[model samples]
Target: MNNFARSEKKRQHAAVDARQVLRALREMKQSERPSRVRMELPLPQAGVENDKIVYLGKHGQLADWSGGMRQRFRATRPLVDTLLEGRQANFAGLLEDAEDGVGVWACDGDITVLTHVADTTAGLLFKLLRGEYGSAPTREGAMVCVVNAFWTDGGEKVGNPWEFKLREEARDVLKAGSWEVVYCLRAVRTAAGVPGTIWRRYPEPWLVLDETGRVVLSKEGSEEPSSAEVAEALNRTANATE
Candidate 1:
């Protein structure tokens, strides 16, 4: 068989094996299959920042590393309790509080993100405010983004690049942390015609990728997953089976 044909056959076999293994596990009742937690809270309304600590993306929950602009959405509870709940949640790194709140920089394989101590709308909190991430061209195939917000004495928004003025302690922590990160700041125009800078985070859909791109996970317009759901989708047509 051709290389493409061989790879396609292998992927199909892998998918079939995955389904069988999961079925066996469920049948044996050894452990429950992993699933997404659906505990998102009401999102924060816009125009609500009155010296507010921050913002969030996606149903008011903590930001996922991908989905591009969805990072600006916020959630009402801790993302770790849901998204990264159980073994997927990594807690091995420290991120200095933003002179405001407390949290840790978590690493999930090649992925690195932050999770806060508490999930309150007010008081000391590590607000997931909006910013830019992967706006620049780089050797890495995928782009990512996060924006750190600061305001001026007159309450005007003073732009702060993620690369500039990082706490020394935080910098040291990142140096030896999960992934090796070395990035330079780049300026881009904001929607309001002002210039700003952003820091990139790990790419997402969690752990599904290959030589082509993303492996399929779900059907179109489906609200919930089905029994056939697999992290990597089968990405080819079947043969005649002669």
Candidate 2:
């Protein structure tokens, strides 16, 4: 082959090798990363706007209430689907069993109830309408009564402790069925810019449970916990109530 043709062939071969290496790295990363559970709820037709919904706090104004409800339905459509199908679906339950059950539901900016109980079967089933889970009738309506799981690394510099702490406090609020409380976890970005890594550290396994005692999610720190630490935090939180 001509020199120019030979050079072009070599360039093409290099490009192919690079692409193959990148694909392999991506697959490895995906396999090593923790699993995440997400549910998308449907929104009401009358109140949705610009894809953003409001979450009306318990004492929020009527206008705010309407917007939040719309957003929540839009976000949790997946969980609603499972509920309607009469499947034994519980996000928190699954997490708890997996030992990575630190769950959170975004509430789609609408009203959401975080229940103290880990079991969410009954609540999920009750929300179904004609094999579908619909939005709450009012903007002030409450979505499912459970927290979804979220995972974070504590060893990072900017990690916020509030993520897991809020789950602990949520148990108390869940018992009251009062939506007056809101927990906020803040973390400042470090020089390295790791998200949610600068806050306090928790080495325990976090859990998310439905009201029906199902563990939908669970996560442990990269460092395994001692028997005592596991028993203290996990067991205690499992039994906590609002």
Candidate 2 lDDT tens digits, 161-216: 55454444334323332221111111112222211101111222433322232333
Q: What is the TM-score of each candidate against the true structure?
A: 0.22, 0.19
**Best candidate (score: lDDT):** 2
lDDT of each: 0.25, 0.27
Q: How much is the lDDT of residue 72 in candidate 2?
A: 38
Ten-residue segment with the worst summed lDDT in candidate 2? 180-189
Model 2 lDDT on a 0 to 1 scale: 0.27
